[model samples]
Target: MIQRFLAPHRTVAAGMLGRLARRAAVCALAFGIAGAHAQETSSIVIKGKDGWLFPGWGSLTQVDVRGIDNTTRLIGQARDLLAARGIKLEVLLLPDKTLFYEDRLPDGQTLSPEVKARYGLILCKLGQAGISTFDDAAVLRQLKASGQEVFYRTDQHWTQASADATAEAMARMIGRDVAKLDGRPGTGMTLGPLFNERRYGDLAELFLTADEKKQVGREVYSVRRQAESSNLVDDAPAPVHVTGHSMVQPYFGFPQKLSSLIGRPVSVNWNPGNVGPWIVLLEYVESPAFRQQRPQVLVWQMFEPTFAQGPDASGLWDNASIMSANAWLDRLKTALSH
Candidate 1:
């Protein structure tokens, strides 16, 4: 699907370079101070090359092999439990933006060998564990190489185009595994025309000061609108459910795209903050919604950076969301059993 847009390579390349130049100018003016001093201003935001900003939480060189193994084990157990209840678990592990844009890292900042290999390692581990997952990194990389910005320059979330592309890929995977989905005809979503808007990304909004924001300026974002007249019919339960963070929110058009492509209603539950995937999953499965009508396919989306961080990672996840790995599994078991 993404390959179809490659025919306009010249046009897209010109636009891409133009945007890069604008962002580079803005970033240069915004961070006039020395690199070390600029980093001191915001502990949460990492100043990168060409006016790009990254979240500090996702360290470029942090790789915990043990953590990854533990996470894989937990996910495998969760898959078994969900399988028993006839729910097909599809794990969507989103690689960090840095993986794709390492060239844009701040001066002297480079990805360590471990960081470079972490994603592939996790994918291998997941496969070895017999867990069903997809290589989203490969999909995004392909889009990026084709001149499509899969991620925002100053935000942690994915762009609308990337979301649509991913949804298309995920739809293919789901279709192959589930064979069919149960939903009413014409229950899918309709995507409206694409529109462009200039806005400060989350990193800039949260970390940059008023003067800094003005200097950095807002970048143009391509957004897809949901057709105003389109609405999902609630006559039957949604065959698919997506539980994740801000990336999967309606604002980014991920769920809607998935619904439209799958030709079925896709129920979604997402929290903006880093609530952690474990808590997000438990929240959905434990809710009355799950008891009333459980989805046939559960798309559990998680970030690669935090994939290794267990449910009890103190500072990473909120206090309420934190718990022992065993405790989380227990709750999941109870929820599925009920």
Candidate 2:
């Protein structure tokens, strides 16, 4: 029964998995024998090829299928509840950086078959549960294939180019579902000129020692400034609300790009650190912002690797952010009730 349901969305081919395993074995052997130089400075930071650093928290081998199903079921329930209040919920599930830069993984490190199939499996489950989502993996892959760097080599956050691309794609999807949004004319944000800046990545700053950081070096990033003349504040309540981690923050230009492309005012709330998506959502719905005027659409963004983790992932999520799944849902229900 499960196979039948997932057949249509199964993206990983058995042959591909076999090829990946063979390639990984050869790379492991080569790196093990010849390249003895330490690539990682810290256990939590993975040093990838060509100065690319990835967070070690995301596993390249583990895929908790049951956890994914439970997460999706909860998301579906949230969707139904939001629908009752005339709000459309769209989940923006961002794929891990490892997916796009598999070749960059240090010598022997490669994604396991389960990790390769994880994104597709979650998407299938979300679909089955009647939750709205888009294939962000496909969008990022296309952006990478086009020679644009989707993510920074040194930073955990994505590049502005990728953010713009994803925002455009998301806008199109939102347009299809919502014919028009509630906002006055000329309320949308205006994007400013793009500028280049060089800096050390968050990973390099947080985990790497002084010597290790020098070795990794700084990377040039393209950033977009908001127009100086643009007035973002308006009396009309924003019809679209975004809730997510630092990835969707204004610094990355995701929410700004989304507002420009969608031509609607987009209100956003985000927290840095591993606060987890569950708590982030609760924080938003319970805030005075949600009570002032409920948005017509709510975009909930989350990382794909951590998607399977429930709200009560004690050690995985930050100490204060952790809670049982039922407890999280109960809070959500209470917040939305008013």
**lDDT digits (tens) for residues 1-338 of candidate 1:** 01100000010145643553344334323423112110012257888887888887765655666576668778877888899899999998888888888888888988776667667777776766667888999999999999999999989889998999899989998988887787765667766899999999999899999987777679988888657667433344678888888898777888888888887778778775467888888888988878988999999998887787889887778788899999999999999988
lDDT (Cα) of model 2: 0.77
Candidate 1: clashing pairs of residues: none
| TM-score for each predicted model, relative to the true structure | 0.85, 0.86
Give the alpha carbon lDDT tens digit for every residue of 308-329 in model 2. Answer: 7889877778888898888988
Query: How big is the RMSD of model 1?
Result: 13.1
lDDT value, residue 140 of candidate 1: 95
Model 1: lDDT of residue 61: 57
Ten consecutive residues with minimal summed lDDT in candidate 2? 1-10
lDDT for residue 183 in candidate 2, whole number 0-100: 74
